[model samples]
Target: MSVMLLIEQVLNGLQYGVMLFLMAAGLTLVFGVMGLINLAHGSLYMVGAFACAGVAAATGSFWLGLAASLAAAAAAGALVEVAVIRRLYDRDHLDQVLATFALILVFSEGTRWLFGSFPLYLSVPEVLSGAVTLPGGIEYSLYRLAIIVAGFAVAAGLFWLIGRTRLGVRIRAGESDREMIAALGVDIRKLYTVVFALGAALAGLAGALVGTIQSVQVGMGEPVLILAFVVIVIGGIGSIKGALVGALLVGMTDTLGKVLLPVAFGTVMDASDATAIGSALASMLIYILMAGVLIYRPQGLFGEAH
Candidate 1:
């Protein structure tokens, strides 16, 4: 491939990685802190997309839609945690999974009932709708680049929140010993709700950001959720740093594989066959990478060994 094309693909990979990080970050946090298997987390993502689309359509402003997404998703997460998740904390993973899976159905049908079976469209804000030139005369989508920047900014903000804030201290404490923190006067229940809401807001922001590029529809979050789970598994269950690293690796592997694999195969095979075979292998690259990582570091790159 040409140098310019390669650079563009790399950038695309970064954008996709950022999206995955947003989804995975929340998922890891919830799993790590609450020890809850939340199949319904994806539902919060769908909620954000729908909320963003609906509000933006009503208000004629994407900004309002974005805000609505964060609010709606956070609210939904908090409500879910209070009404359902708290009960599951004392239950086994099987119960958590089954209950949350039921939640997926509740959310899907509820959304379909409200929005109909048709997909909703979200337009990129006017200011972010174009392309920009890079140093080597490479042109890239301004919106995608913005997403990469925003994702990193969110990462930095999360680091600051976790490392510098009191709530961060509480979160860390809760992860280590929820009972001790509760004994020390921390409202463990409140902390769980807040953390869950924060995670939900992140997922919502991801959904809203991506909705502009894709259709905002029911069940949209499920596929992304699967990838997010893979990301957390590869990165280590609860490590944000691991999530970011794992997401970038996955994004690069998946994106570059699709581009490069076909060309590699074309060298020795018929063009049509090469494309077909290459695409199939490209689909397997991330899983292969995950398995390799497991072989080398069973706890993941950043996960603490048990």
Candidate 2:
């Protein structure tokens, strides 16, 4: 491959990794603080994408769509927490899983009913649609680069929110001992709602950003959701830093593996067979990485041991 092509792929991988971090960050936070396993988190992602697509299509304003995505996802998350998820907090993980699974069905069907089964396309905003030349004379898409910047900005903001603020302290305390925090007169219920909504907002932001690149449709979040789970697992559940590192690792490994494996195999096998085999192995690379990490560090790289 040309050096320029390799550079572009690397950029692509970085962009993808950052996006994964957005989703995984929320998943990790919710799990760490609330001790609730939510399967419908992806549905919030879908909600964001749908809200963005609908608003952008109606008003022809990407900014409006973006705002709508944040608002809609956060609102939905808060609503779910108050009406359903709040009940699951004291329940078993199995119950939480089942309830959230039911939520997935509701969300998917509800979205399909509203938007139809056809996928919606979100155009990149005019200002960000073009490509820019880098120092090495390689051209990269501006919108994708914007995503990388935006993702990192959000990550930084989240870290600060969790590490340096009053809410962060409360969150940490809740994570360590929910009963103690509640006894200390903390509004544990309200805190859980806020955290859930915050996590949903992050997922929604990721969905909105990704919608510009891919088709926005019902069930679109499931694949990314699974990947996000893998990210948190490999990074150590509940650790934002771990999520970031794991996401980047998975994204780069998946992207580069896909590109490089084919070339490596082409030397020894027929071109078609090499492409097929390379694609297959590339798909499995992250899972292999996940297993290796689990074997070496069961609590994950950043997780607290039980």
Top candidate (TM-score) = 1
Checking candidate 2 for backbone clashes, the offending pairs are: none
Which window of 10 residues has the lowest lDDT sum in candidate 1? 297-306
Question: On a 0 to 100 scale, what is the lDDT of residue 198 in model 2?
Answer: 92
TM-score of 2: 0.98
- Candidate 1: residue 149 lDDT (0-100): 99
The per-candidate count of clashes, in order, stands at: 0, 0
RMSD of each: 0.7, 0.9
Q: Mark the regions of model 2 whose C-alpha exceeds 4 Å error after superposition.
A: none
Residue-level lDDT tens digits of model 1 in 1-306: 899999999999999998999999899999988888789989999999999999999999999999999999999999999999999999999999999999999999999999998999999899999999999999999999999999999999988998899999999899888999999999999999999999999999999999889999999999999889889889998788899999999999999999999999999999999999999999999999999999999998888787
lDDT of 2 by residue, 88-152 (tens): 88899999999999999999999999999999999999999999988989998999999999988
Worst 10 residues of 2 by lDDT: 84-93
| lDDT of candidate 1 at residue 82, scale 0 to 100 | 96
Candidate 1: regions farther than 4 A off? none
